[model samples]
Target chain A: MIKFSKQQLKIPQMSKPVYLVTGGMSKFDRAIPEKRTEELVIDAFLEAAEFIKKSPEELKEYIHSCYYGHFADHFGDQLLGEAVIHDRLGLDPLGNVGIKTGGATGGSTIWEAYKAVASGYSDTALAMGWERMDEVPTDEGNHYIASAADKDWETPMGHIYTGYYAVMAQKYWQVFGKEEESFRRTLAEIAVKNKGYARMNPHAQSPMKITVEDVLNSPIVADPLRALDCCLMSVGASCVILADEKTAYELTDNPLLLYTSAGSHTLRVADRRDMDIPLLPNESPDQYKDLGVRFPGGDRYPGFTGFLAARMAAYYAYGMAGIVDPTEDLDLVELHDAFTISDIQSYEDIGIRPYGEGRTYVESGDCYHTNPFTGQPGKLPANLSGGLIGCMHAVGATGIMQVIEVAQHIWGRWSEMHADEAKWKRFNRVKPDDWTDLQVKGAKRGLAISHAGVGSHVTATVLVHPDHQLKGRG
Target chain B: MTTQNRGTVKVENGRYRVTGNFHYAYPNDPIRDESGKLLGITNPADMTHIHAYGGEAPFFENLSNAKLLGTKCANPKCETYGSIYIPYRIHCPDCLMRNEEVDLTELARKGASVHTFMITERTGAFNTLEKPIRFVNVEFEGVSTILMGYLSIGEPEIGMKVVPIFQTKNPTFTIMDLSWVPAGTSVEDLPEGFAF
Candidate 1:
């Protein structure tokens, strides 16, 4: 499987273009004991309907089929949870399916809905996702997450998913990072930035104005990765509605063009085989010839350092969207910052920066909303919704929430949605006195990367304004 | 208090023969808020699962005997012929043909080295390993992939040579029976119930 066939590398071409009409998210937190899962799901759907100026009953009329994403059914002690939600939402008699791809479940659910609209099976479709990780204790929740790994080979080792994932972070820390003190601080800076961004997001689970030293001083889950470096294990719901061009305008005046592509690797990192690096349009074969000379042990393609799945997903997505380079082509990104180190790795995987040089994205002040060095807007701000690190990692709802965050900027409604005092009061969260608008000015295109455990499955979702889409798309 | 007899299973004539209790049920408890308002109930149960490894059973069965087993794609017509896998593949991924089981005990003993390692002091429920589990992804000289296991003794560093040790005595018949240690360690210093 290392070598690709010509057919396998073909760029996906939809019969017709699909557009994201509107999307919404509920208040995300570590636990919501006062309400059942159905209530949170209804809250998300009601917001989406409200955004488009439609009633819940009116929105349900356009949904021909349903796709629900709910990871770890065992955690909720409910089998067929999707059906329960579908019935509660009053969408029955129409075709519906469930998706479970670990952390990427939310994106994969949208991927299915997008294809349904593209293939002419349905003019409009509903993609809803949610998770209830609070039903069980933290230790039991960790065991449920680890079950996503190979149960026999990996789960028996420690029954903790973080230990299985930390090996890659350790390798990246040593080889590319060179175990430098400054490099460790750069990793901590991501936590500080994401948590700071979370303070402005009322739905965010963890929000704190902290320094890099605070992150370094946090408890060590594993060597080189502190407690703050990890993402939150949250509970919440989020959803999006996809439609064709004709139906999109009917639903909303502004609809962003949407494209989704996915890729996967072996469940166990132990099974990864050495392969030649798949070059993106921005890279050349000669560009990485001396990677080993620059950083020893860095020549290995995806050798516990790079996520081949993310790279492959980006490969197809960029091709489909007619993107040659991400940083220059896209306005911003919402990367899956499951861990600070993994966030750096993804910057390289998606071609924001070349391999072994992801640290530059953060240090050069390009990843910030406002460049700390230049005192101007950052070239490409990342994770403005606080990402998994600060916002929430409610498994099934995470990816959908990331895409909705990006679309708000494209719709020129980021301020309208986020700056509402009613929303803060509704969620019962106190609005900060110094809340700043994080809307990327003149945003035309953006991307969100949804990833699963240890690079097992990854999906790339690219949303561009129909007026700004690139010509000669693959 | 009841003396619980855990469930056990055996395959006889292609059918499962079960003995003792396979599941136990507990009374559901009401979960209420401080105001004594009803919200939900807790459901508790314990159960056992029967899993068959199928084609890869040989790899686990030989671990208790202090043997490391791997698989090789011997298909001459395939694109990737003679590729060795430590996490033994049931069949060649490139070709659907069955793979030949090859003993990798000697190869692992002579040339295994640590590619990457991590130490974690936290574990989830049902974890049996000691706190601060030292995980090492070991690379063999002629293997196509790396194998993940724990270091039984000493700290781990990249490119450090290590040798395999098995819990030949009172084996658990799981992946836990196999471990790794610094290559030149003396036999007397091995962990309890383990041998090189």
Candidate 2:
């Protein structure tokens, strides 16, 4: 191990010369019209504009450039998507780009946007994606995802997507010994939570909240996982606003100032020879100590396939924020609970509880169905915004929605948060120690986790809450 | 001797022909494992053969003689799961889970039933199984979807009992050695035993 002095261990906090704030989306997927590519991006750009009460002239002046992410079957359109979208916004574009990152096109898009703001390329840039994938037939879609697989070795061996996830799920069951009942109950809780969120969201395909028994009886997708566990194929668009600290104040009366943003992407899974060195998310187990995860021995106690990726991401975010003792500090998280299992693992991986204590945390009424930290009644909070599960996902826009949830939570739009049958319970409050850790000690650093693939990633971003008392430059 | 490789991704330089060894499912529609991997099927079970020279992966030679069937864990880590994986891994690359040639109890082929299925209107193998052909995901109690073949019967439903029935490609594709049927059935309801 490379041991360093305590003074040398400190990581430099990056400074942004310009701010790119607010990420926006125009629905991840819908029965989008087969129109010219320009029309689709224009619609998504307008949809993003709707989130903020921005005027054409004022919006044009603050907006610097745009980055568009898309994955079309063929090189259908070669024009700059940013230019096309910006032209509709009628802005003097300083920077405009378009990229494709396979299934992760959306998350990669936001990461690119964050880089632009950090690089001082444009003061306030827009990163957006629009894909109407229903056009690709299911078989053709299968072919597309398989295109990324090792064509000769893996594909010929009949290693398809579900097979890979099934192998992991089965292995998780073998390791955790957390029987089907445990997986079932966790999934039910996630489904109910997301459906509740969808009630407030008109765009969600399944807006009605369902019961645990309802999911238990549903058709099984794979052996253990049922239909309810999968995300729907829905059509929608969304966007999140990212701006500089000063511009954040000007963007809205309440602005979620992004404190630190770091993300990593892996083109292939098997290339990494060693388990210790995870290529993506670029963080290690030691880093978790900084992210406020009170892991004993500074090592991740392994359990669950989906949680590992997220844990790595959280560890990096923790390093950026210098957060320790995460279980007590952070309050209110909006993670990519892509599947029911993903939600369960986040509970343990994010240091809410020790590893293997995830199942017990749920039973003790901690993670979902009730706010564990605050014990707010009628709150089945996690993915209240229907998440990707209830909201359905089109890949690229899911991360933007995750950013929106954190913003909405800090904004006190309780309805926007996932709380079912939850009447505003003003009676309960955070325990004194917990309260200090959250409101004062860790309030400046709120953590958010996002994942990709089936248990493939974890992106934890620590958003430092801006305080009026702080003398830092606005 | 050296060519700065431009497009040399493909490795199968040997032209190992598989002519007339085409595998068919759903009467003709080929069955592919999820992730859209085509599960290799031989039209007639007899036509199915493997030629691994100086290779590994323990083939259960006297598998028919002994009630137990087994395969070596080319992937040792995969050994814990009873080698249940179709196209079983030699050393389980998935979990890094290790295992050797562990003893495995063969599944009771008699009580096999359709777990879940889709009467495909159209899919990858639409030509093989027609728009209305049944492609049920079946599990023989103790096994996975490792078993895939023709179950010539009525409508494929949940828990519909099917014996180890096989078809032929010109030549009769039949499980001649192990002609099995439902555990308990009336004489009138007996299946016609066929061997290719």
Candidate 3:
């Protein structure tokens, strides 16, 4: 028998503690053609400044540096985007750097800001992401987005962004062996549930209520994936301020701590195989294939590898936070639902469900606001800000947008925002008597997951309310 | 003795062979028509090319000759020694050893099955098809890697047997030169590969 010793996993610790002071995002929509990226950033920055209780000038003076995330300034034919934003904001000539990590650009920028504050280099730092995709035609915009895939292999074969997910959806259907109609209905349910939440979020672009039937009836952008299943391309910007413990206390009474963060990436999805498939058969006698196999490793399966990266990221973050089970430990979640299939796959990838059982969790309504598992209200509400599906995806802005939404839930300020009354009444076709049911009440801990490319890059973060007591700390 | 008063020194066997040279060009200059209508460019260059070495070179050359090739791990201790890779890599991912090139024509001749497929109806920059184009992820028998190519037939079903149809005539020396058609389709009936 081969003896395998337990391996110790190292979790990143900050030299100087970092805290999330506040986060804000502009209303995500396709109608923002008149608004420039700088204007959107300024709007979100001002909104975030309001939470600090400091004058605009004072807040500006406190910020030590700025990190901007943007995807394809060529979409609007603009260059020197970071310089333009820096000039418009009138920040001191300390330093401002631009970041680009495809869809995870927002989260990557935030991570950079966190490092600045955590490293004791800055007392306060600003991370912002914006995209003005509406400036170009749909094809031109798609051309910009397709630049994320492998230019040599994937793009030449006519595999666009939607086609990548569509292939995964098809493979998912094959692996599960469920009825075609039933599988599609489950996907539609995911769309309906997300759009239902979008109706409550004021920042959502398409907050209009949708049905499973409506999703199924929508035109197929890529087979197995409808127009409704894909996220809307919109123009928006999101900003978050990170600071040290002292600065956080000065900013607000309810500061959210950046507990743990992890990110992983694969240049191409084809390079890695799916984790769901059993690489080595249980009955096989080949010990080499069985023992050497690692999750997110091996090329036995053809499914998307992004889910494996997500799992790896989540494990690192969860380990750092001493969280054994994310599904139960997390009070709420903000996941990257760029596509409906992505949401379903995330459930399994994030350890919420076992392999090939993502659809089962979705059908059980366990992830919804009203938890069927506990027969209680707000068990673990996901994508309360409509996610990328209903909230509209501004590419680079999505990661920070997810962080902002999770922060809002942790602060218990989600329900205070305006929601369409009529649409709220018709939500899920099972309207509750009170509007508070829509909110995840007393959410002390939340997780935000974001990804870019075709599951090429992924980031997972855990946030805890400042008031919440830690296990060892007072 | 000659070092003190040598006007010129002769070196023996000093000539070296030049392995390669790199050329760089930029298309910063704009071009205009005779009337200065502002056309595109005269000597436009992207300066980007696929850098191929070792097994990758043969991988493309085989495609030009209407054949498929894969890389096999040379290390006997490697777990996936016998298995083949479609996009041939120089080093084995698991064992970290250089791989040996292998011909995959026989495995492909046995035909492959559709692991998964997607049809895109919405046209984009690369997808300029009048109708939806079906792209299939094929799993060649005995091969470890999956090859992504367009399906020459109509709607593709899971587990459908597919045979590789190479564009031998005037091949573009790209992965686009190869596609998968249904197993029973006659050689004369195979559709043309999708235009890149």
> What TM-score goes with each of the models?
0.99, 0.59, 0.82
In Å, residue A350's CA in model 1 sits off its true spot by: 0.5
- In CAPRI terms, model 1 is classed as high
Model 2 chain B TM at 0.41
Error of 1 at A347 (Å): 0.5
Which sections of candidate 1 miss by over 4 Å?
Answer: B1-3
Q: Write the per-residue lDDT of candidate 2 for residues B52-170, one digit (tens) a residue.
A: 42212232232233332323435443323443432233444344544345333335445466533333232221123223334433345443323332233455544566554322212
Candidates' RMSD to native: 0.8, 13.6, 9.8
* lDDT tens digits, residue span A1-474, model 3: 011124423466678778888887776777464456788888788778875667667778779998999977767666778888888988848699998878878878888898899899999999989988876568756766766777556666653667766777766655552436887898887788888777667677876577888998998887678889888888889989899999888878878888546555455555553333321111223432442132222234325422665766676666656565666677888888888877888777777765556777677776788865567765567887778888878877888988888887788776654344643332222333333436677888888887877676677877887666345221
Better model by DockQ: candidate 1 vs candidate 2: 1
Q: Which prediction has the highest lDDT against the true structure? A: 1
Cα lDDT computed for each candidate against the true fold: 0.94, 0.46, 0.71
Order the numbered candidates by lDDT, best leading.
1, 3, 2
The order of the candidates by TM-score, greatest first, is 1, 3, 2
Provide per-model DockQ scores.
Answer: 0.88, 0.04, 0.23
